[model samples]
Target: MADGSDPEYVAYVHGRAAALRRTAYLLCGDTHQADDLVQETITKLYARWPRIGRVDNLDAYVHSILVRAFLDEKRRGWWKVRLGVPPERPAPPHPGVEERAMLRAALTRVPPRQQAVLVLRFLCDQPVADVARALGCSEGTVKSQTAHGLAALRRILGNPLEIGMAR
Candidate 1:
């Protein structure tokens, strides 16, 4: 029951779902919320399929949408108050699981805007200019956000491995 227009869109979504889901999972720090994020982004993408499908950087467009969506949710006061929701039990630890878990916990401690900035810059390997453009912010804001986010992450993670040299 699909419109079947733009085979490339279909192919792109199929191929990139896992990657997008991983990014979303990192952004939201929850599997169910990550799934929701991907679903919402794909739905928006479907609505703009013809136009977005013609763009050379569809992945970037989708990522921008996801980040914007997360920011919008935060602005609407979703994270303003605690809802007393129980934390989901994490899976058993692997070799690097503890490190990753610590990172995720550190990420969740920051504001959503900082979280978006960090994930896009660090996790997605995007440049400051690209991140600023994608987030519709000034390059200075991107720099400040990157600095503060990195500082906060370091403080939370006990200054892990020299602030910001490599990911």
Candidate 2:
């Protein structure tokens, strides 16, 4: 209802919120934290709607915002505060849940920047150039991060042969 309130911006947020939340969840491995990241990113987008609307790839721009938000959250010391252990819940009775859990656990062990690179490149299916632009790094840095991320994942997962390093 303010000056920045525009139909296109509303539509863009409506359309992309779920995807952004999913990406955030992958980065943080916690649904509540992911929601916070998405909310922060959306708040930023609303404040910069005029400028962001003119970008060639709005999705990429928003992704860059989301990734940066996650990184910034990591840099803050408050993120390390945990009051108590969460209640354990049974895993979903679905196929591939174990594999998904394994991958996610390994992902959590990776450094925040490398985790962002892996999530953007593999999970979001972003190209090296786009990822570099999003992370404000060079293409070569992205590539190196991807390699290191994968290697760390492999080491955590404990199967160098099983995990195929493709793309």
TM-score of each: 0.71, 0.75
- Model 1, position 94: C-alpha lDDT score: 72
Please provide the root mean square deviation of candidate 2 (C-alpha atoms, Å): 4.6
Q: Which stretches in model 2 have alpha-carbon errors above 4 Å? A: 1-5, 53-56, 76-95, 161-167
Residue 153 in candidate 2 has what lDDT? Answer: 80
lDDT digits (tens) for residues 1-167 of candidate 1: 22337676688789989998998877777899889888988888888886663566666778888877777776646344333765444775674666666667667777778888888888778898878877889999999998998888787678546433455
Model 1 residue 16 lDDT? 86
Please estimate how well model 1 matches the true structure, expressed as its whole-model Cα lDDT: 0.76
Model 2 lDDT at residue 81: 38
Please tell me which predicted candidate would have the highest TM-score against the true structure: 2
**Which tens-of-lDDT digit does each residue in 68-93 have in candidate 2?**
99988876443233326552446868
